[model samples]
Target: MNQKKTIILDLTGCKYFDELHERIRIAFDFPKGYGKNWDAFWDFMRTECDAEMVEIVGESTMPKEFLPQLELMHTVLSDLKIENAKYGWNFDYKIIS
Candidate 1:
């Protein structure tokens, strides 16, 4: 039997829809008219890796009344929402064999 205790943090200060949207926009660099690409968005959602799951953990204070922000983060990170490789394109990934 193994027991582990984990402490989670939300440093994005996402406490409302606006904050969440801003975070999403900045995090994923969504176009100004991203709403027009719902199909592409949905397709990416169906096939993508999670950002957090494959990268470093950020520090954020979980703000109350930030359901929208939280949901956006979760959605974008999971394959059910967006593509990870495309999301963090600015970062360079080096493969070691």
Candidate 2:
């Protein structure tokens, strides 16, 4: 079976980590009261997410402070892919300008 690719991460006008998390929650249709943190992100992605590709927009324009979190997100997604290897599950992202 083939799943349609989805771009759930776009930081075009995002200027803060909280804003980014809200975008993520909205994009992924996360339920209310969702924890807007890395652990929450990892748990959701590992157990419930089905999006194949999460395109990250505005890489160049993101605030300097956002870079650290962005890198952490990349790491989390990468780790998610690895941990789900047993199920042959895959996740990927692309940074767009």
Q: Which number leads on lDDT?
A: 2
lDDT of 2: 0.79
Candidate 1, residues 1-91, lDDT tens digits: the string is: 6332222322444455554444444444455554423344444334432233222123244455554544544553453323445665321
Which regions in candidate 1 have their CA more than 4 angstroms from the true location?
A: 1-11, 36-60, 68-76, 79-97
Q: Rate the local accuracy (lDDT) of all candidates.
A: 0.38, 0.79
lDDT of 2 by residue, 20-90 (tens): 88988888878767799999988877766888778777777787877789889889978876776767866
Give Cα distance to truth, residue 7, candidate 2, Å: 2.7
RMSD of each: 11.3, 1.7
- Model 1, C-alpha of 38: deviation from truth (Å): 9.9
